[model samples]
Target: MITVFSLIAGMLLTGMNYLVYRQLIVSFLSKKTGLVCISVITICTVIYISGLRIVELPDFLYKTGAVCLGLSFMLFVITLFYMAGKWLFRQVSLPVNQRKRRFLSLCFKGAIVGAGAGYVSTGIYSGKSLPRISTIPIKIANLQRPLTIAQITDIHLGVFLQKDFLQAIVHLTNEQDPDLVVITGDIIDMPPEAIGDTLDPFGQLKTRYGVFCVPGNHEYYYGVNGILARLAQLGITILGNRTKQIAGINIAGVYDLAALQLQRGPFPNLEAALETRDPALPTVLLAHQPKFIEHVTPDHRIDLMISGHTHAGQIVPFSLLVLLDQPYLHGLYHHDSITRIYVSSGAGFWGPPFRCGAPAEIAVLQLTEEHRSASFLRK
Candidate 1:
C-alpha cells in the first residue's frame, strides 16, 4: 500500500512538472530544452521524497532537490491560474489577428513568470524568518494560580533547518520564562548520527518545571528510541503515551498516530497514559496531530489538548488542502464543553522553505480561570 501511494504521488508531481514546463517554457524555449527541465525536476522531486521517507543523501543535494520541488509546485499553480484567466478572457473578447494574439500571449506569460518569482522570493524570506509569538489565553480545569506554557513543535532539525534555528528559537522561548515548555512532536528530521550537538541547546532551555516532549511521525522515520534517549540525557522528560503531574495539573501525552502506520512501538496507548491521571487536577494532553481530539469522550474529561503536526498547511493553497486531512489547522478550538485543543502552526518549516499565507508561530498559552466553569465542567 505504501509503495502504491508513493507511485501515485510521484506520478502526480511529475505530471505537475510537465504542466509547468508546457505553460512556462514551451512557448519561449525549444521542446528539447523544456524536456530537459522536466527531467531534472523529476529527479529532484524523487530525491526530496526519498530523502524524507528513508534514504539519506548529501545535505546540499537534498536541500537543492527540496527547493526544486517547491518551485515546481508554485509555478504549477501560477500556470493553472494563468490558463484559466486566458480562457475566460478569450471567451469574452473580440477576435484578433494571430500576430496580435501571439504578442499578448507572450506579455501575459512574462508577467506570470515575474509574479511567480516574486511570490517564491517572498515565501522563502518569510519561511526563513523567526516565527512570531502567538499568545493564547485559555482556561483549564483544577484550582491554582494561572500557568504559562511555551510550545515548540515540528522543528524538523537536520537537512533544511539546523542548530542556528533551534538556538534562536530556544532564546525566544527562554525569554518567555514560561512555567513549562512542551514539544508536541516532529522535532528531528535527520538520523541520530547527523543530529549530534544540535540538541545541546535544549538543555539550556529554562522553565519552572522543565521541558517535556512526545514523539511525532517524523521521529519514527529516523531512530526514535535513540532520539528519546538523547532527550532524556538533556534532562527533558520523554512522555510517549504517559502522564506527568506538575503545579496541580495532570499532563498526559499520547504517541503520534503515525506509529501505527510505521508499525513502531511502544505504540500510542491513550488509555494507559490517562490511567495515572488525577481527576481533581486539570488535565492537558500533548498529541502531535490535532485529530486525536476525536478520541475524547465524556468519560475522559480532558481540559486542554496541545498539538502541532499540521503546519497550518505551511504554504498557501496547500493550507486549504490540509483541512482534508487535519481536523484543525492552527490556533485553539472548542472540541467539547470540557475539552479545548490548540494546534500550533508549527515553529519550523517542512518542505519548501516557503511559508506564504500561513506564518509560523511559537505558541505561548496562558491558562487562566476566566472560562473555568463555562469551558469545562467536572463530570
Candidate 2:
C-alpha cells in the first residue's frame, strides 16, 4: 500500500512539472531541451518518493528535493492559471503583434517564477523561525490552582529540521516556565541511527511536573518499539493507553489511532487509558490525532484533550485538503459541555520544510477556575 501511494504521488508530481515545462518554458526553448528537462525532473521525483526507502541519501539531497518539489508545484499551478486566462482572452477579438505577445508572455512568466520562488523561500524560512508562544486559559472544575502546560508537537526532527532546531525550541519552551511539558506526537521522523545527536536535547527539557509524550503515527512508521525505548531513556514518560498522576492532576494518554489504522495491535485503548483514581478530579487526555475524540463519550471524565498531527495544512491550498481528514485543524474547540480539545498547528514542519498559511506554534494552556474570564497571552 505504501509503495502504491508513493508511486501515485511521484507520478502526479512528475506530470505537473511536465505540464508546467511544456506550457511555460517549451516555447522559449527547443523541444529536445524541454523533454530532457522534464525527464530529469521525473527521474528525481521517483528517486525521492521511493528510492529513499531502499538506500539512505545525504541530508542535503532531501532538503533540495523538498524545495524543488514545492517550487515546481507552485509553478505548475501558476502555469495552469495562466493557460486558462489565455484561453479566456482568446475568445474575444483583440489586436496583437508577435513581439508584443512574446514580451507579455515573458513578463508574466518572470513574475510568476519570481512569486513562486519568493513563496517557497518565505515558507521555508517561516518553518525555521521560532514558533510563537500562544497562551490560552481554560476553566476546569476541581482544580486547586491554575496549571500551565506547554505543548510541542509535530517537531519532525529529521533532515531539514536538525538538532539545533530542537534545542532552540526546548530553550523557548523552558522560558515559559510551564508546570508540565507535553509532546503530542511526530517527535521524530528519521530512524534512530539517522537521529544521531537530536535525542539528547529532549533530556534538557525542564518542567516542574515532568515531560510526557504520546506516540504519533510517525513513530509507528519509523519504529514504535525503538522510539518508545529511546524516549524512556531520555526521561520522558510514554503514556500508552495508560494514566499517570502528576502535580495532583490525572493525565491519561492513548496511542495514535494510526496504530489501529495500520493494524498494529490492540493499542490505543481509550477505555483503559481513561482509568483515573478520582472521577471528580480534572483529567487531561493526550491524544496524538484530533479525530480520536470520536471514540470519546460525553459521560467520560476527561476535561481537556491535547492533540497535534494536523499542521493545520502547513501550506495554503493544502490546508483546505487537510480539512477533509482532521476534525479540528488548529486552536481550541469545544467538543462537549465538559470536554474541550486544543489542536496545535504544530511546533515544526513535516514535509517540504515550508509553512505558507499555517504558522508553527507552541501551545501554552493555563487551566484556571471555571468562573475566571478567558485570557490570552502572546509572547
Please tell me which predicted candidate would have the highest TM-score against the true structure.
1
Give each model a TM-score. 0.92, 0.88
Best by lDDT: 1
lDDT of each model, Cα atoms only?
0.84, 0.81
For each of the candidates, give the backbone clash count.
0, 0
Q: For model 2, what is the C-alpha lDDT against the true structure?
A: 0.81
Q: List the residue pairs that clash in candidate 2.
A: none
Q: Pick out the ten consecutive residues of candidate 1 with the lowest summed lDDT.
A: 370-379
RMSD of each: 3.3, 3.4
lDDT of 2 by residue, 244-357 (tens): 988767889999888888898437988888765467678999999999988888888688899999998888767767779987788888788778888999988876777887
Candidate 1, residues 1-379: lDDT per residue as tens digits?
A: 5566667778889889888788766765799998897788888887777666555678788888888888888878787877886787688774478888878777877887788788888889888899899888887655487999999999888777898899999999999999999999899987777778998989989999879999888888787888888889999998887899898898899888887887877688889999998888898999999888887786798888999999988878788888898888887888887788899999888877888878889999999987634332222
